[model samples]
Target: MSAQKRLVWPDVAKGISILGVVLLHIGIGVPEGESTWLYQLNTWLDPLRMPLFFVVSGYFSTKVLQFTLRDVLVKRVWFFLVPYIIWVSIELWTKNLEWQWVFGNEPLTWRELGLNLVLGHNMGWFLHALIMFNLALVAVRKLHPALAMLLSFTPILLLPLNEHIFFIGKALMYLPLFFAGVYFRQAITAFVDAVCRLNVPALMFAVITYAVGFFSRDLWNQFTGEVVLPWYLPGMDYMGSQEVLLLVRFVEQTFQLPMALVMAVAIARIPYVSSFFAFIGRNTLPVYLGHPIALTVGYHYVQIVGQWEISMDGERLVNTTWFWTFVCIILSGAGGLMLWSISKVPGIGWTVYPPSLRQLQEMVMRPPVLRSEPCRD
Candidate 1:
């Protein structure tokens, strides 16, 4: 679809999702053993945030399914792979420097790099995982689209993969929701539309779903941490008990997805709010890439300036106040905007934000020059 003709709601949804991600990251950055209202809020919204992002990604993937495999791969390379590699390298380098400064350790080794590549570590792992997911989907769709979707669901119900593998596990965990967006596009669209119309029943359903999901999350967190699982089940000795894990998954599948969708739709229906978020949504790429750096630097700066003896282990923020959370948010937004500005530069920008596949192809396939004049000889 043309840019101007594109749907607004998805962008609004994305805008909201990215903000959620930022807030979640900020919450996580708070020192261990510290708790705040902001952190609790982030925990409540966790199930909805990333799943919503993946679903939207899958929904958009439909647009490219008709392209040749070569074209699709090329698009993925430019849009996701290139940026992922660049950003991951940058992130790792900075992290290595930080570690070295703090502990006088050696830089990351080749083995570490290889393992990270395999596991898709770092903040840019989402982009790496998205590339893999797109390629896998493309391959599966070749057999049959329905079959591809059917296969995606298997991972959701299966036992969780080792969390140490990080990105791989996350990709597996989220695959079904992503494919649901692809296969159930029409239904999702209709549902969003119905909710946007402020259908009273739909609103009520959304509110109730969100409440249940929130409550379930609280219970899950409690059980996983302090409260023991009440009943013994097979694999209770595992890192995450199977029965409790299943219940958590059930909550995600049943309540979180619908709540996220309804919230997105409701936001989209509001004229001013939708417009503001849509702007952020449209520019999420730069924000996503830049925000981590911003957060990292901002946190350190705050520590140094405030002379707060906060532990380097992320044990606690200097002051665990709502005002500090607001400051972090502002810093993140400013950092994102700075990155966006950098991405507009002519030559250097391409390093941070590669050209679109179409642009790259156009540059490669420009018209051959016509020999208009005879040879000088």
Candidate 2:
């Protein structure tokens, strides 16, 4: 398959996973196991979203195989960095008013602020470490294929051995996985194609994942106080933070990646569902940026109306956590899509710009109809 064609599942998966990622952060509680089994689904899903995102991202970057050091840095740095910095800067400007009390840390001075604006911090670390991975790859871009593969994982492996630069660690840490996606781009594509061919199996996998995720949440809650899953979000704990050991991460990542891929592929197979979800997938950046704005504004309004009680876990405000959870998903997706579309115009692009090529291309380039499912991954 062509390099461009090799990415369909991952692209779709990327959109799906981001939603999962945002939901985890937005939801106060893990939907592990409540009285009903439904919540465990996200638990199962929760693990996979971020890893596949990184892998698919890695898979595609490696697939393009067209990047130069300069080309890689400019786009990777600017594309991710620019928005991350700008958004976090906005968060800082806004005092991250919602989360300020939730996660208070050292304040940024003018100099410190400017430095981090460049260096990136907190949730913005994805861009910072990603830039590192891209720049590191520049050295091997022209090297023999085998050598490049070996080199990619170097940064990822060295991560566990370090105690500092936790933010920078993910760069090299996931590089191998990224390159692995690229390397096995063919294999992954083939596997996905095969999975797509077996509709029953794919759907079964999706349903089972949903159940698995739901159950796991129950399992985790039953044991979280003692289980020490240890992979808590960065800075959320006092152990100063450390990357998950490689082997454990491998076990955990496999479940989530496959869960995400199967879900994306299964969704792609359906018509009405595919179109609606794919629209969300393609316009991912907007949903990512704008939803928080909505969440922030809405959270404040809740307080003013004397309804100041919004549970991150929806159990308190609604009939059930599931109801509000779905609401969060829809609002996040719509908020992102609307804001992204608005940002596409010249002046407003900075707020929630579409990825330039596809958004423009999609306007004129019709999304092909999937007849009996396309063969590419």
For this target, which candidate reaches the highest lDDT against the unseen true structure? 1
User: Tens-digit lDDT track for model 2 on 266-291?
Assistant: 67767676666666567666666666
Backbone clash pairs for candidate 1 read 31-314, 31-315, 31-316, 32-315
Off by over 4 Å in 2: 1-8, 29-39, 99-108, 112-120, 156-164, 199-247, 255-259, 304-331, 354-377
lDDT for each candidate structure: 0.70, 0.58
The TM-score measured for candidate 2 stands at 0.68
**TM per candidate:** 0.80, 0.68
Best by TM-score: 1
